[model samples]
Target chain A: MPSSATSNTNGHATSHTKALAKPTVNQTPNAWSFFAVPRPIKRIFDRFPLLTYPANRLPERVQRVKSADGHALFIWCAPEDASENRASFNPACLRWQAFLKSQNLQFHTVSSSNHASTNERLPFLVVNPSCSSPFKSNIVSAHELAKWAVDQKDSWPVELELHYEPYMSLLNNEIRRAWQYHMYLSPNFEAFTAPSYIHSQTNSSVVRITSSWELQKAAREDLMKSSPRIDVEGLYASADRAFFALDNLLKRKRRMVADVSAPSLLEATLFSYLFLLLELPLDRWLDNRLPEIARKYPELVELENTLKKQYGLQPPAIYDALTGTKDSTLNSRTRLEKHFGIR
Target chain B: MTSRLNLKIWPSGDGFPFPSLNVDCLAAIAYFQLLWRTTDNAVNWTIISDWDASQSPNGQFPVLSCSCEKEIAGILNIFQHVGSCDSINGHSDLNSWMNEDELADCTAWSSHVLTLGTQLLDLYLFITYENYYSTTRPAYTAFLPLYANYTIPPAHQKAAEKRTEHLGLATILGEIDDEPRMQPISLRTGGVDPSASASASFTEKIGFGNRKEILSKAQKRMRLESIVARFLEPLEELLGKKRYFLSNKSPSSLDALVLAYLSLILEVKVPDRWAAEIVENSKLTDWIKREAPHIYGNAPNKG
Candidate 1:
């Protein structure tokens, strides 16, 4: 009765009827006809074997992963083409892919946005069932996927395990702050990151603007949490110290690769942050400090180059934009100038 | 074995297990009761309506104290915590009708309501001078001592103003005023009066800023109407003829959220009833009226 009254006044009476009509039947039922499905038919439909789809299906030969902005979720390192190493712009996705590659796990990349993710984040992993396990394909991300890898015995050795939490905290806190500040809070957000990353995640202009605002607000709040106010100078100062510490750590060992023959979890995490910072087109926004670190630190640059070769990651197009590399066809200089108003 | 769960909310001026005055407390209680009824969980929850929020973990209510002595603050956190507990039933029968896609839709719609609906509520109750002075301020500070009543309302108003500014809606709507503008009539009369030459001079000194403020406020109110319209139209379309917002099945959490906001907007009496009038014209009013008795166990008296 309430539905009828509301529908009549709201001018949705027709649509209401249409909404209730199942697609296959295409017959509009009366207002009270929700109970029209006979009890025997319901029972028979429930018991029908063909009607029920089996929960488990054959595992896919390759794993499918979703990244933000429909970019490939892996570093594309073509031996023949050094420029092809830059595929995905998302550092988190690159980190995840690099970690998987370091473990010698085989995965195929697919372009997807954060909207497809269960957690509304980028870089989710989908594991296909193998002959050894009958479990269906499972989608996991973040800590859950990390745990899955651990369960499969693809984890850091005990020596590196002691340093995992400390190093992770370092990267998550100091390095993450710098990254968020560089990407979201910086003035370039409205010009570059917003259009390139955030806007591409959604088609709706309202959602895009609102989401960008919320994301920036969250980043600001996070930055403010450590201090009374946002001290950009102090933040960068600490960031410089953090980078310095990381540079020293990597410099001492020639590479972060330990005696276990596999790259430690620390190396994976470090590479994730370092590669993102070194590769991103934040040259215009950044105050020359981080870029200076990449230039001055031989070990850091060497590690990045080594990882690019190891993972077969093609340099992303953003790399060309940052380096002012001119292409014969598109002319990168003109494109940057026209779009970003940079001469 | 059933575990003892205690829910602490803001104390009500009137003695009631659930206060109808505070919309958040009402919604929290409604959400708790709905979950309790739909699940086979042995949750012996006692509503401590008189509890103060100061003792809470985050200095806000409603706080849920679980059997494990972990205090979860805020309604969302409390719900998530309780839902994750082993004692409570994992899945609600209300949500069983929805598929994964429908559930995702429900979440998106629920977020929309929470964000826009709360902003609308804030605008109606706190930003508009008429409603703030006549209704919201009194509702929050009436029970306090004279000194506290006088002090707290302005503080609360300032905080609300700050929040609106942070959300950027205030700037877009042009409500960011450093000081309240003097009336043009006061300036005009002072300038015209022969004996009040000094007052006239003072009026002239501040008149430009005052005029801009008045004009901006007028412009903002007009713009606010369109913003509210944009928010409501999509929600109305999504609801369509379904009993719930996004699902044809039983009421989900999104239903509870919609019911909470709609009921609050309709039932709460305020001087600036622009938002309430808008709600009255929509199908949401009828939905709230229909669901009130079932959710709250008693029909809420419309203000």
Candidate 2:
């Protein structure tokens, strides 16, 4: 999911002009000016407890950027075949849509054919800054769009949710091969519904650069700040909400552990098991860092509280309760099994 | 009133007999029965197979039925009257019940298998109808141009002469002689081998190389049986020790299709050496014996 906020560059024009005149401040960081200086993301790092680790400590493969309103934009893509069954909106696209819907974003669906026709004439607008759109515009040519996004970064705070459909159809052509390579550079562009056939292109399931407090800090320093902050809490809360839907749909009310259904018990069972496996560790990460993260970005605290109350997740307290030492009294013995509707 | 269904499958007298009533139609019958059961046994359905030898009804399939209708339209009308239910996708109330992802998964699986099977049928048609083969040994020369003419006239004649050494001409080819001047070659008449050729054995067993090769080759060709094991292994693991695979719940359409295909493959007997070895293998033989009987039953029509 890409972040909804982008930076409005129009603000601080006088300060930018003054900084432009000063050669010291204007000096390029190596050849790429963007690479040299730490953006507003630096302050975002200082906001979280464990996440405040130095910017260089993070993995280079994961790129974090901001939307126009200074919201973090995290994007990824999944390439798949042109089969008729999945022609309109495939499983990967549906999953992304479901995720977006869960986040309470106002979404729009446009055909790649329509986008290709009008993209050059129209400037892509970041509509519904409050994350109201359930969907982002799915641009056809991701590489060109990514390059265009980087070029237009100075002009507007708009983020590109680049669609990877064009490259998929060109698998036979050798000359236009490095579309995926170009895709890696666009920090905000995401590919969706990636086919199993395209797995060889990248060694990842689907690239998702989780926009954390660091990216927000980058926007705070380098981009224009806006009022009302644009539903930052909703972004995080939506993820848990989607999980809650799955819970209601799949799990028996009493078991707290989800078992597979007869038609697809194997797939469902594995999916449920994997979700729990990922959630336990994630809950811990959120719990330990909530206080400091709450202080810096108050929305994060509210998001954390929502997750804790709704999902029965408390990273730090649960960790203490499970440790079961003489010093601990949390009584977290309520088996995680009960949560999945298992006996 | 008990509605009687009179099914007439297409291609009239000589097409692959509507899988039912054919010597080996049990698997197809089981499939139809399961299809009915999956739909809550709603429709009193009859399948009519039209053989190729049957008369064409003025560039249309011949169909006759009651219910104040005529032709294919009449048959369908009769079906509707008997079943009183629209097809699966056409049912409105059923669509609401099917919106659940569990039902969606079954539909998806069925569609996936149907697509794959349909493509394979297309390939089979292409091969059987278009490909050339040896007239003497149809089994030995499928999809291969075994009867193709050689360039040189004398060489082609010489090659044709040696073709007879390949197999017993009468048994390998049809017993009927095409050339009126040539006498009929009778080896086996009425399942009894003649005294002269009785001492002689069939050296070529269709696809097998030689009589001596059956043992070593049977051991080597044991891998084909692994497919049956592979198919059943997933059912056991995913389905667990339960009757159905999805959850320990009632079987859905997905289970029915898979169970039918498994029985068909198990029951499909071919005299090819590889197929024989596959049937002879204890693991596959035992698995087939256990699973096939449970899914299907002793010849329903025969009783």
Candidate 3:
């Protein structure tokens, strides 16, 4: 988390004179001056040759939507996709989507890539292209959505208790690592994740393959930080333990739901992960154990089902269908031959 | 079936617990202490102060060479192996006594502490420039053999860097990620220490001389505030007014894990006391004052 603290540098006249006289501290020594270097030496080094480097001209890769619509949440998705019964395929995006629905914040989903958001991640909410309002900002990025949602809701009945962050850390580290491993590093990457996130972005085989490899590599590197390798048993077992803990919490207290019936961020968070795990198309998920792990906790499955019923946002992806393998009538060799126009 | 049990763990100093230097090993030690008490000393084990992890099952310790000729590594597996012994009557783990929920929470919190809490320790011990030079590095010498000492601490610090790189805390912690490893430390001593000495407020900014330095100082403080809140506040909440983390009556595996972290943060004599200063005021201080001596025995004289 970057701190928003801005430092006020008030310059003094005396200090300015001192700074001008001195060679300056905390900077590279100029060839002329020796101590912080002396001001005379600094003046001498000021004549040294300077080189200029090219300023970065690379265009922003993100989707730029100019609030042409009211309350559109930009997320990673395919085109012509309606978000009915379709939860976001991305857990980060899905969490907010569920939260928005649970909070009854009126918004339509826009299928935008991660590049569209200022944070370089997705699920940013854009408010009021149709109207100008001082009450709300133009864009609410992913992390800011919770506070943003609160403002959108005139009354938040319950305050987030202290236990929220710690327990959330449980999912953030344990379950997230497992999810990353499953989606990007697991055997399912070639079949399911690649086709869904990377292949769907472009028809170019080179772009798709390269992006897929980079994505998997990044995931592998991330996983390797806490684990020796993609330790399947260890990651899954940790996630299972986390699920079991969440299950117990759900049973003991309705932390996920703020009121007796009003769902909170907790439900949104747990539901997004559970939905991805349980509802992800199984055939495309080779050697996948996340769904199996999540299913052990009845509460998790119930949460997913309830959230799906309320939000009606199941991820609009059947990976097999997305990749045109929904016609299981043809075997792999025939499918390849058909793809290439071979008789 | 008469093979004696031997646990190879990271070595620590004489005054602190035997396996105190590493938090994971400390947790394992606490579990062993519990097993010893629960089973009435029926199960005995030896602690081999080993520096090498290459032979360990999971490439780390506490590797327990059990009587059944099985070499088990990782704290949880070690707990399972010992708890399953006939002496303990097949509890299977120290956490097995917990109800399903408590047991699950114990496991989850353990994972939480191991990753995030351990990163905090990494930041405190390995990342901070002065603390690493003046405190943590020398401590490594007391724990490892000479040649091993030279190679090990750097490797360990490098791992810590890789582990928490995503946090983007290097600059805040006074470490520059891309700079040559030693260059930053030497340069920081010259630049940061003078400001800190001039100001003489150890808890405050290292120095905010210029606009860039002022911004860096503000960022450092902000990052510090957030990290302490994110990691420690919940721990404080969970442990509010309790003797142990889960129960008022007895200590659980969770206590052992918490003990591992708290003892290091509070007891380790780091020059950079920013992290400890924040946690010191929290409920953790009271818990440590009450429970640490009971678990790990008295602290060694700093003198």
Best by lDDT: 3
> Which model, 2 or 3, shows the larger DockQ?
3
Sorted by TM-score (best first), the order is 3, 1, 2
Instruction: Give me the TM-scores for chain A across all models, comma-separated.
Output: 0.65, 0.18, 0.71
* Worst 10-residue lDDT window, candidate 2 chain A: A158-167
Sorted by lDDT, highest first, which candidate order results? Answer: 3, 1, 2
Give per-residue CA lDDT, model 2, range B113-148, as digits (tens): 332332222222111122112211232122223342
Whichever of 1 and 2 has more lDDT, that candidate is: 1
Q: What is the DockQ of each candidate?
A: 0.01, 0.00, 0.27
DockQ score, prediction 1: 0.01
Model 3 interface CAPRI class? acceptable
Residues A1-343, candidate 3: write the lDDT tens digits.
2333222122234344455555555343332222234556668767774578999754442233453434778876655463443666788988898888888877777787877667788888877566437775678898898888888788663434654555677788888988998888877776557756776667777887789888988888777666343556656666777788888777656655545356668767888888877775555457668888788888778877877887767465543253456556345335533433334
DockQ of 2: 0.00
Question: What would the TM-score be for candidate 3 when compared with the true structure?
Answer: 0.75
**Candidate 1 lDDT:** 0.58
| Candidate 3 residue lDDT tens string, B22-74 | 77887777766665665555455667778788776556667888777777776
